[model samples]
Target chain A: MIGIVGGLGPYGGLDITKKIIDETAARSDQEHLPLLLFSCPNLISDRTAYLLDKSNVNPGKAIAAILRQLEMAGATIAAIPSNTAHAEPIFSVVQDERARMGSTLKLLHIVYETVRFVDENYPDTTVGILSTAGEQICSLYREAFIRKGFVVVEPEGSQQEKVNNAIYDEDYGIKAQPVPIANKAREDLLLVMDDLKKKGAQVIILGCAELPLAIPERDYNGMIVIDPNRILARALVHSLAPDKLKPL
Target chain B: MIGIVGGLGPYGGLDITKKIIDETAARSDQEHLPLLLFSCPNLISDRTAYLLDKSNVNPGKAIAAILRQLEMAGATIAAIPSNTAHAEPIFSVVQDERARMGSTLKLLHIVYETVRFVDENYPDTTVGILSTAGEQICSLYREAFIRKGFVVVEPEGSQQEKVNNAIYDEDYGIKAQPVPIANKAREDLLLVMDDLKKKGAQVIILGCAELPLAIPERDYNGMIVIDPNRILARALVHSLAPDKLKPL
Candidate 1:
């Protein structure tokens, strides 16, 4: 059974779940894919706070506990839909959980999966990233892309502020509201995307799940905005259940 | 943590999950409700088949197994969203599981809860039911309402056929598509509602989860069409997390 470890900013969880439903060609209810979702929003500590502030709470250990919960329930293959949660610390904790609880749950790592998709599909060597400051400070995407032999570019100076404003704006941040598409946030997001394009970055990665709410599927002018959540979902369908991919 | 036992039909599972999200007054991800969903569409045998055909596979046994899976994973409160799954046999199996495993999972019985909702809300004594043939043969809603001292009215022979057609129509059925509103089914569903209204049913019930898909919320002319799924969801929120309802 496929287990979805979510509740990391609930909208992302809902977005990926809905995408899975839309992607599958289920004419009737019985025809759809079997899924198990463990939505522990409060259980896991905030990745941004933990990573940026060196908070006492270990998000990695919390994630491992949630994964162990899924394994106990009967999930052979599972996924934590948060890109920021797929860092090395979380992976290490997962290993620890596997050792302690004897868990065999194979996680679909969103960051690695998105990078793989980029490597295979896009020819660009330098990619722009739009993500939370936590991911930026953690060098989450930068180090991974560098290991894959690609140069990564992020918004510099005030341009970075605009991206952060669009993401963390109380009324307009992608996580602030039920629907993430606010006019003000969209306007600011467009500026950030344009600045990234001007900075010699060929492709942009919407590393934050909430980013897609402002910058739609084809918002960027000719530049590919890789939504890691969508990529993770596609990778999951392709790897775990390829036949479900036929509808999309 | 709340565990949702769904995928008896995929959309119902999604609908309830979405309702929980919508009902909550969560500004950010952390404040939202914690939910674990096991969408085991293939695992449970068809309810109608088991209820009518004397099928060897017991739906009660399947539901019990799913509930057991949830309890094993750390779900203290659990609910099965399927209306027809609350039959005597299913309850018996649930009792058996609880006895065998010493389960402390508090199950929200959808049928009983819905009946209680009707008892407390509407002053009118008569009600109409639009549901699947399985529910009709098993007298699921009718018996429950009768026990509550409410007069129950079902669609007539031809009218019942039309209701069933609107619900089970391969292409037009609510379960046939992700979004329940279908034009052809809606047209026929209106006729069924009008017939029930003419029969002096003070309130009409979308007894089957799929019925609400074909018949929109406001199609019952002057009468109230009770959606049991929404009622179940509301009951859950009210009982489990009253604080979350502040935003709504």
Candidate 2:
């Protein structure tokens, strides 16, 4: 069974969970895929905070524990939907924990899959990155795209603030209370996507799962919004049932 | 941690998971509750089919197995969101499984909690029941309400067909495909609510979780539509946390 190590922002995890069902070629309720979710929202430290500031406690150990818990819960392979949490430190922790437990719970690399999608489809097109401050600080998206031989454009400092506000603002942030989606946040996020388009970006990557809660699946402005959540779900489907991989 | 025994139907499981997040009073993601969800959608047989036909395979044993898996996954309390699957035989299976395992994973009763809400808030008011034919045939809602000293009213035969259509029809049924909520099904289900109001239903219980996907949570013809999903979420919240029960 596919396992989800979620609650890295509850809405982001829930978004992936819902998308898995939407990604399946299920006509009946019974046709959907089986998913085991360990949604421990309270356990892990804040991803952006830990990555942004040295004083903040790192969530690597906590994430590792959760992954082990998912493995114990009968998850053959797992995906953590938090974009910022995919740093080298956290990935190392996951690998170490799996090795120690002798568990074969494979971790789906969301960024790798997203970069591959860009490499295969967009090829030489310039990609714009819109994600958390932590993701930017850690250079996760920048490094991934650079390795794929793709030009990456980031929002200007002022525009980046708007993106952060759309994701972390108390009143309207997608990660803020009363979530899943918000209209005002969606409109604000659209403005950021528009800004990215003006910077010669042909494809935009919603590197963070929380971003998609504000941004719709339809093309952002005219640029294609590559949601990591959908990409991860598709990758998961292909991993579990390769033969059934034909446009879920 | 609260464990959700889901995939009785995928959307029904997702609905409850999203509601738990929505009902929480967390200002940040860290304050939300931890939820472990085991959503093996294909594992169990169809609830309606089995209950309505003796020839059909019973899902009781399969559900019990899923619950056992949830218990193994470290869920202290559990809830299954399928309304029709709340029959006596199912409950007995759950109890029997827990007994055999010597586990204390308490199962929350959605139907009982919903009836109690009506009994406490709209006492002595005539209540309308809109649900699957399985629920109606089993007299789940009617029996629950009558025992609580409240008058119960079901749809007329012709209107019942519309209710069933909204729930089972492929293009628009809540459980059919492409779910959560549907517009045309919502409009059709609202018409049934209007009929219930005409028959002196002071309050309406969305007896099935899928029904709410078709019917919006608003007063229908001056009647309060009591959503069992929301009721079940509230009940779950209370069971997990009695001290935090102010307003969600």
Which structure among the candidates has the greatest lDDT?
2
- Alpha-carbon runs more than 4 Å astray in model 2: A54-56, A135-138, A176-184, A246-248, B54-56, B135-138, B177-184, B246-248
Candidate 1 per-residue lDDT, tens place, B119-178, comes to: 888855688888774654238778988988898888878987887777777787655542
Q: What shift in Å separates residue A126 of candidate 1 from its native position after superposition?
A: 6.3
| RMSD of each predicted structure | 3.7, 2.4
Highest TM-score against the true fold, candidate: 2
Q: RMSD of model 1, in Å?
A: 3.7
CAPRI class assigned to model 1: medium
- TM-score of predicted structure 2: 0.93
What is the number of backbone collisions in each predicted candidate, taken in the order shown?
Answer: 0, 0
Cα-lDDT of candidate 1: 0.75
Q: After superposition, how far is residue B119 of candidate 2 from its true place, in Å?
A: 1.6
The C-alpha local distance difference test score for the whole of candidate 2 amounts to 0.78
Question: Looking at model 2 chain A, which ten-residue stretch has the lowest summed lDDT?
Answer: A174-183
Tens-digit lDDT string for candidate 2 (B1-248): 88888897887888898888777777667888889889997888887776667646767777878888777777778888888778876667767766887877888888888888888778999999887747543387789889888888888788888888887888877667444566767887888888888889989988777676666665767898888878787777778876544483
